[model samples]
Target: MTADGGPDGAEPETNTGVLLFLPYRALENRVFAALAEAGFDDFTPAQARVLQRIGPHGTRLTDLAEQAQVTKQTAGFLVDQLEKAGYVRRVPDPTDRRARLVCGAEKAWAAKEVADGVVAQVEKEWAEHLGKRRMRQLREALTSLREITDPWA
Candidate 1:
């Protein structure tokens, strides 16, 4: 190890993937804070993640699990909690009788509205720091990367 604690003189920087998660974690924290302020304090972070992946129309449990990168059992457990809290409901899938679709309930829609506002506020703050053009470019870059990184997206 050198003086900088690396093999050579150079210091190591944070991994880009971990760095990317920092902002996401911050946004998640902000969203939780906003949700708590709105009196929606029953939801947990894990449940919120599953909830966020649910399509506007509805989504299968397997898809939710896949998108959230969690196991089917874990996703089902989270969905059960959300259902009990009135945030989501399981409905019969029109296409497949054996499958059930998780649909956002009225409370979920209301919470989504709040979460969306918080996301917009955070994005505005990030844009101010990164400059509007750079922020747009950043979003475009990330979106493009999703094609390779996110199998469900």
Candidate 2:
């Protein structure tokens, strides 16, 4: 073992970016599983990423693309697929006559309910593992990090 008690020659586990991604990916897997169990097997991971970024009322295509870290064309393509799947619909933006807003539909709401339940279950598991105090601290730390890490937030 090295001086830090890690394996000899092993790299230090200081990559907070990667550390953050692990839980995110795990949560995503659970969400996907929940969606599949709900018979919403038509959705793709990419589409889900886009869908998650959409605001409750509606969101612009450009904003979705920005938040999803995808090109506008890619966002539009995913939106089209979501539209066809009956999970989302594009309505004319009231503020901008030329622009459209993507809004969640009935199917999306149903899937969201399932996803929310899964998230709550996973969070409860995490809380049990970390204990309530540590879990709260973890959330607070992550929320503080968001000030620096999240552009949209």
Where model 2 places Cα greater than 4 Å from the true spot, the runs are: 1-11
Residue pairs of candidate 1 with colliding backbone atoms: none
Model 1's TM-score against the true structure: 0.91
What is candidate 1's lDDT per residue for 1-153, written digit by digit as tens?
212445555567666777798899999899999999999999999999999989989999999999898999999999999999999999999999999999999999999999999999999999999999999999999999999988666
Model 2 worst lDDT run, 10 consecutive residues: 1-10
lDDT of each: 0.92, 0.91
- Cα lDDT tens digits for candidate 2, 84-106: 99999999999999899999998
| TM-score of each predicted structure versus truth | 0.91, 0.91
Clashes of each: 0, 0
- For candidate 2, report its TM-score: 0.91
